[model samples]
Target: MNSKTKDAIQIILVILSILMLLYSIIYLVNYYSENDILTHFPSNKKSEDTDLLTPNEIGDSIGGVLNPIIGITGSILTFLAFYIQYKANKEQRKFFYIGLNNEKQNRIDESNKNIDLEKKHHITNLKIFKSLVSSMLNYYISSSQNIKDFLESEEAKPLGIHLFIFKTDSSYEYFNKLDFKNIYDSIVYSFQNKNEDWENDFIKILNILNFYEKLLAEMKNTYKIHSQSKAEKLNKVGESITQEIGYVLSDNELKNFDGIVEFLEIVYNSNPDNTPVLPEDQFKGTDFERLQDEFFNKYLEKLHMRYNETANEKYKSQLDKFSFMNKKIGVEKFQTVAYTKHLREVYENNFINQTNFDKVQEFLNKINIS
Candidate 1:
């Protein structure tokens, strides 16, 4: 039975036992007095008043017989009361422990569920990274083969379209000055004047690039949840594509192209002890002066190591040089330099003020010495 009900029943039994004891004492006293039993108990006395015991003597005799019975009953009642209370306390303790165990089990279950969810999240991100990398490789392969085949063909030489013509100074705005659609259409139209096969090959390359340009926009959203290394590789591939195409076009032509600037801003903010002394941690608008200065500073820190290590003499010569540039820097440093520089020139420029130039000087003073 429940503890409460059991306690109530125990209370009733004790009360009833007390009432029965009281009733038995009252009934015996009345029966003895009414029958004149106490007065005749000795059997020698005839006169009622003289032979009957005194009131005090009768009271002592009654008490002598009843006290032991009452004591025994009281002892039994007390023991039962204690036993009932002990049982109730034991039930309460059991319930408490059961509740504690259930709560602990619930917390463990919740923790396990959270761990599973995190694992799924990690797996999903891995799949997304792999898929993006695969698409990037596909884009590279398809475009490269098409370009190579086109260049190797005799018909392509007549167009005077050496791939080198597509190369520009790393910071040039030759592509940004004009519209992408116009350039695309112009190239396609020029190909239309040639054989059908040439037109098809040129269109194929253009289509691949166009697809990648769209994919970059999507990567901006995905990269926020991915690892920094994956994002860095993505940024590198994007720069390589833009460099080979000799132009930043479409969404890539934006100042904060594909949110890459914002991403880099986060990186710079997260790393406070890094060697490069940034004037600011974020890009709020078209603050090209500060941005360009930071990029230039990173480039100088690289010491032209990438240019010297490159086997392609033409490619090495194409890199901008400074007396400060050399081969002592590491690959990671060169990548950081190149990536920052790419961010600076990927879009159009705005006029810089004297104050911006002063900020640039201050930034340079701090990092150049360090």
Candidate 2:
């Protein structure tokens, strides 16, 4: 039963016991007084009725009154003692019940705590995955900046004027980046574990990852990119550049980049100089192709490392799986925000998701995604 119900029952039992005990005590006192159980000072049993002249009648009447009081009192005491004993037994039973109930509740509470811990880590780990993705993408785009300008200037897009800054490895910048990653991971882990001090950080990371995911998906769609072929489609996204036939094609529009090179070499060998055939880039010319390749490879390497790194960090403990998952959740959420703000802007505006925009605002309150 519930605490309130148990308390009410206990109260009723105590009251009944007290009443019975009081009745027993009162009855016993009256019975004894009437009987005159003063052992040392004995009462005279012989009675003299001066007017009626019947001593026996007087004594019989007195005895009749005393005997009933004595009997009633004894019965009351017996009943009272039994009732009180019953109440005490009831109390012990109730105590046992409470202990059992508390044990059950404690188990449930611990389980819930374990569940919460897992959720927290999952979120954080997800965020980490996204961050790695973002880092790879950023590296590729930034690395290709000079090549983009060169290609465009060669009249592919036709503007010599560039508008973006060139940023190399500044010690401070590298330090700041490392610090940010560490802090982000720490917060995610702490929140998942329900560390009281990290409550605010946990909430912040959650909003961050959600925003990053929305950004990346929207951006990818906006670019209208398609894979090279049916076979290529099934390949991991990171391997896009190394595949012989790429979606990004040259001018002759040959499916395979290597095919273009081989064909050109064959023609050149046949006719040394009669409008010589060109390699892939000159024919289907993209200036940044070579540079893009370098960064793209790095990006793939980064993505592959995630599986190994995360598994190792988790220690592959079944007992700690929940904690690991909770970290992932946080990471995923953070990644959403990072991608949305950083990468997607190149093509479209998807700062917030359609379904969760309102909730996103509520979670982050007022902050710049950029």
Candidate 3:
């Protein structure tokens, strides 16, 4: 039975026991008063009332009535004592279960805390690795002569040189004189044979590029997991409070108050749109290609300006070609203001030291690929 029912039964049994005791007391009082026991006392021994029994007989008569009532009362009292003990034991068991549940919850919370701490440590290590990869990429891009030769070759068709001298018949002589075909053939032979220093450098650069792609993917995944965990914890907190109070705090507002989102953005190097600033897919053409494109484009721009100032007939066809390509490609692609502002902060705060900062910045500036 339920505790409430058991309690009610116990109370009823206690009341019945009290009433039985009171009945027994009243019965004895009436028996003595009605029988006039004083009439049979030693002081009135000379009385010849044969109907009055001896004192011993009256005692036996009282015992006959009281004995059964006493046994019944004692049984009720005994049962009441055992029932009270059982209730005490039940209450103790209830408290024991409560304590057990509380201990289990504490253990679960401790495990969660350790897991969160481990994730944070992992994220920090990934950030360091990412920075190292970026530095290595910058170093290779700036120093690799194989990449430079490839850019200038006819096969690569360095964008600036192509625009300046290969667009029209009038400038074909300048392109032919550069002997880019021979340069292209030599680069191809060396790459295929893998016997040149430039070839080795090229392979190393490719390896670094591949590593960078994987690193970016891993970093993005880790950051996403960490951010989601924080969001879930915040949601849990919101759920624990009253709905009216929870509604007063918007999700974004709650995140702002915690500062976790902002901290994650900074740590993960994300743009304001929540996209990673240096996205994994960003290196599809490779940073080297972007660098080559930017370099040649700048070269053509300067050449065009020089030709305009000098009014030289010798440069007329080339400048015309430069103008057409410049117009076609659009100068807007060359604007690096946004990249410079964002990356400057990123490098200063997280990735690059002052020693490597200029090289990294220069590499970033030359990239036009979105």
- For lDDT, the strongest prediction is 3
Give one digit per residue, the lDDT tens place, for model 1 in 1-370. 8868877877876876687598668866774775477465634444755556555666677677777767777876887778777887898999999999999999999999997775565444434333343344344344334433433431222211122111112111222344445444444433444444544443454354345454434433332332254335434533443353232123232222333343244334323234443555442322222323453344333324544665554324433332212221223245434433432332112111223223333322322110
RMSD of 3: 31.2
Q: Which residue pairs collide in model 3, if any?
A: none
Q: Looking at candidate 2, what is the lDDT of residue 227?
A: 14
Q: In candidate 2, what are the lDDT values of residues 1-370, reduced to their tens digit? A: 6657756765665566566556656654654455544232333543354223133553565467656655655665566567567767878998989999998999899989996776565555445544543453344345345434432332322111223233342322332344455545544554453434444644554454445444444433532232122113222221332332232233242223233343223323212234545544555322222322332233333333543667543223321432333233334334434433444344223322323333333433322121
Which portions of model 1 miss their true places by more than 4 Å?
A: 1-16, 28-51, 152-370
Which residue segments of model 3 deviate by more than 4 Å?
37-51, 131-370
The full ranking of all candidates by lDDT, starting with the best, is 3, 1, 2
Query: TM-scores of all models?
Result: 0.35, 0.31, 0.37
**Which should have the higher lDDT, number 2 or number 3?**
3
lDDT tens digits by residue: candidate 3, 114-141: 9677555544443433344455554433
State how far residue 141 of model 3 sits from its true place (Å).
5.2
